[model samples]
Target chain A: MSEHQYPASLTHGLSREEILNRLHNRLDEPRYEHCLRVEATAIELAKRFDQDVDRAGLAGLLHDYGKEIPVETYKRVIIEDGFDPDLLQYGRGVWHGVVGVHFIQTEVGITDKQVLTAIARHTTGDPEMTKLDEIIFVGDFIEPARSLPVEAKARKAAETNLEEASRIELENTLTYLIDARKLVFPKTLLTYNAFLTKE
Target chain B: MSEHQYPASLTHGLSREEILNRLHNRLDEPRYEHCLRVEATAIELAKRFDQDVDRAGLAGLLHDYGKEIPVETYKRVIIEDGFDPDLLQYGRGVWHGVVGVHFIQTEVGITDKQVLTAIARHTTGDPEMTKLDEIIFVGDFIEPARSLPVEAKARKAAETNLEEASRIELENTLTYLIDARKLVFPKTLLTYNAFLTKE
Candidate 1:
């Protein structure tokens, strides 16, 4: 109910326990481990791209916090958290990201809009990614698990430029989505189109 | 390769076997039976609404003739049959109707543009269905075997007015598609939008 605040880079140097203490029962063990990996990778990739490693790590750590909520609970939270009705069409697997932004605003108590957007679009992906969002998104993909055959090569690409690595990662993910008979989230398509249309 | 030609209705009521003769090897027994039901239903609805009953019946009978082909083969047929690729994303369920129109036009030798369009839009259920197309489209839905609870009421409504009956039928179908998680064919949405906007 308070003004939607997003604390971008909230608790940047906080240890895993410290981060968990703030999020309360919202954190699950396996997902918490994944968040740590995403955060670690984001920092590593940020170093290669000459960006703020701490901010990128912070974005990654919180990107999927909303997903940790149960699916039925996620729907209730989306309504209670206040999101657009069109977002409901995103179905269960992707609805978490939509609700997650609201979670951060209402529950996690963050106030930075850009950081919230990065986490909001972590799953659906946006056409225009802020530098922090791009780093977090790419870092999560190349995180220790998920090990696709080209993971190492893509991770190496991240060193030179996070944007370039993201373009590759997004293309791979889209192709996989098509093969998987999954819904092509419009935001992902828009993001792909965005990059293609960019100078 | 042949010139477009639509099937003509029989002077004597056509038997299922007579209808099957117009189609080639791909027309199976169950589908053929469905076509007969659709044709019969279309004829009855057209008579009640004072539309072109013969055109309605013929279009209904041939609406799905192209469906049994493999997706790759159907995609080729669809593109070659004059469907734009952008309009072809409703999946293979819709591809058949496109191919069926071409079959009617070129192979069967039905040259009437209205009849061709009726066949084309039967599965898709266009918004601005011609007098002929509306009868065929609505008939396919409220046909005798229709198990849906609303079909009987919709069938009776067709007796009062074809266009009004079609509006209800299309809204019902659209709701069903959304509820069932099937993609609403773009043509159907465009048609629905056109009617809503214009009316």
Candidate 2:
């Protein structure tokens, strides 16, 4: 509601209220609320992981900035901005992170690379994730509103081992996608493989 | 074994006996035996699927031709022959099929494009596979000696629907790779995603 609600460390040109206004402009009510919950969860995770809490909050809040964009717009931006041509084959489940960074940067006026990269990788994780990235990733999944069965275990794991929580979340996401016959963006698999503990 | 051990229709210049000899020379005894089992399984699948039994048998018999090639050699051939450079990152699990097609063509002297494509796709399947490709793919999984728990279910699926069998096999393979923290070739995920039943 106010500037203090956001992390003081998140000092970009726009106030936290302005960033929320931009998110509200793009996302429907429920999606906007999810972003707030993710922001809260990310701050908690940032504390446990010893990362910048304000940055994590900012990254989480803005992660889904492009979630409501039209498919045609994502396609147009992907082609015009020279994003991977292969990205055209997938939709919002993937584009919101891989392509959404563009929107978060230009629209929200956020310039921090850590926050940007964290948002970019929130949907489909990367082969190597920073501690900040892990916080937003785990926070988004374990945020109180997410009711998936894996959420309980991931939240519990987040209390102790962040990486383990991420592995649980990634595994659950991939399993659901495969079972539902959904098209999986390849980076999800890459992230899954990279996160697995070698046996 | 006698000449009748092979189907009468498999006319690829070299006799089936010569193919067996070549396999024996390159593969360890167990690997060579697996190929024979795959050949038999493929033939049985061919009969069920209304495909040419002899071609399926030949494709199955030679599918793993490059499986035993040294990693160094797989790398060298992948480079020298202008194969997909990405093949260099994966080991025998991938190279044996994608890169092995070249060996089957040159060393084994098998010229059937269908057969070569089947071999090329056996390990990591394509987005669109011919019926012959599906046969070899399922055949190699349901072969009698594969003792993994999923084998029985996959074998049963092969009896009624070869595509279902391939799906089960792909799912099992992917689960194992992810659980074991092994590097999975990207195409394997592509095949798995493409094969899932739409819900």
Candidate 3:
């Protein structure tokens, strides 16, 4: 798809350029750009945290792979894959990250369990998260294009402390959901409590 | 306890006077006073919503019956009674309502299912709550002695709409929990989402 060739280091089964091409076809311009920023952000975090930068970048780039998939498709995947039936009540805002992992593994040819887990948890974090998961989660929140004041604070925290950045981002998200009277996915609260109680 | 005799209509298996004596023996002065205020508040809300005032009064008065029990006792009950083991992680703040129903049934001698269910859900509300559950939950938040500005607002809302009041109280509780960096019981979020999406 893209004329560009990606380095082999960043390739997870499929070449990075091939992944970008699929993303371009699937995502609108803005969402595609967001994935790029998240990839860059996650790469920086991975470097700082001593994780595999290539894996982080790959995971971040394809994190929202299923973001633009049709709702009907996601519903069918949820049932067929034996995903939680309760997920049907939520729309793309939640499904894009959770059920999206299916598309990432099968369509994009990324077989790394860690990468898929990070993407699956990007929208609603898990009670126990790996370092890659934290990087992607915070990277998505504090991407350069994000201008929220809370995002700015989280970005500052991400510079030195990934866990603190995650905490701020998670708390801000919960606050926004509660204030707006939006339906909160249960796992988000579980993630919040687990992180806090662990400290 | 005192030289006070409670009305016969408000008795649920146990006489009101006997219940008061047990409460006085178990709870400290402040908690005992809170229970009385909650009872009055629940009664007022019941009258406004045309629910049974006696049931509301009884449920409210005994809602916090386990609040004063030792943490060890609550832990034992959580295990022996087959309560969710995850509940062990939370303190009296959550246990006093959910696991307290057992104590309400056995020790307090209250057998009304509606009354027990209301008390059971007073701390972390259920996804599908009865009118009595809303009454006790809101009563605990908007009781006359509660002076927090949010509580006052919830009290005002309770005067006309129980659902709105419960929403306000739940949101306020969530906000407080997030701000305080406290561990949240997952059911609280479930209750909140269930209420909002139902409307």
Q: What is the C-alpha lDDT of each candidate?
A: 0.66, 0.84, 0.86
For model 3, how does the per-residue alpha-carbon lDDT over A27-60 read when each residue is reduced to its tens digit? 9999999999899888889999999777788888
Ordering by DockQ: 3, 2, 1
Candidate 3, which segments miss by more than 4 Å at Cα? A1-14, A79-81, B1-14, B79-82
- Candidate 3: C-alpha lDDT: 0.86
Q: What is the lDDT of candidate 2?
A: 0.84
Candidate 2 segments whose C-alpha is farther than 4 A from its true place: A1-13, A21-31, A68-89, A99-113, A144-149, A152-164, A196-199, B1-12, B28-30, B69-88, B102-107, B144-149, B196-199
Which ranges of candidate 1 are over 4 A from the true structure?
A: A1-17, B1-199
Q: What is the interface RMSD of each candidate, in Å?
A: 12.4, 2.1, 0.5
TM-score of each candidate structure, all chains considered together = 0.50, 0.79, 0.89
lDDT by residue for model 3 over B67-167, one digit each (tens)?
98899999998998888899988999998888888887777677778888999899999899988899999999988889989999998988788999999
Q: DockQ of each candidate's interface versus the true one?
A: 0.04, 0.45, 0.88
What TM-score describes the B chain of model 2?
Answer: 0.92
Candidate closest to the true structure, highest DockQ: 3
Model 3 Cα shift for residue B43 (angstroms): 1.5
Candidate 2 C-alpha error for residue A139, in Å: 1.8
How close is each model in CA RMSD to the real structure? 11.8, 4.2, 3.2
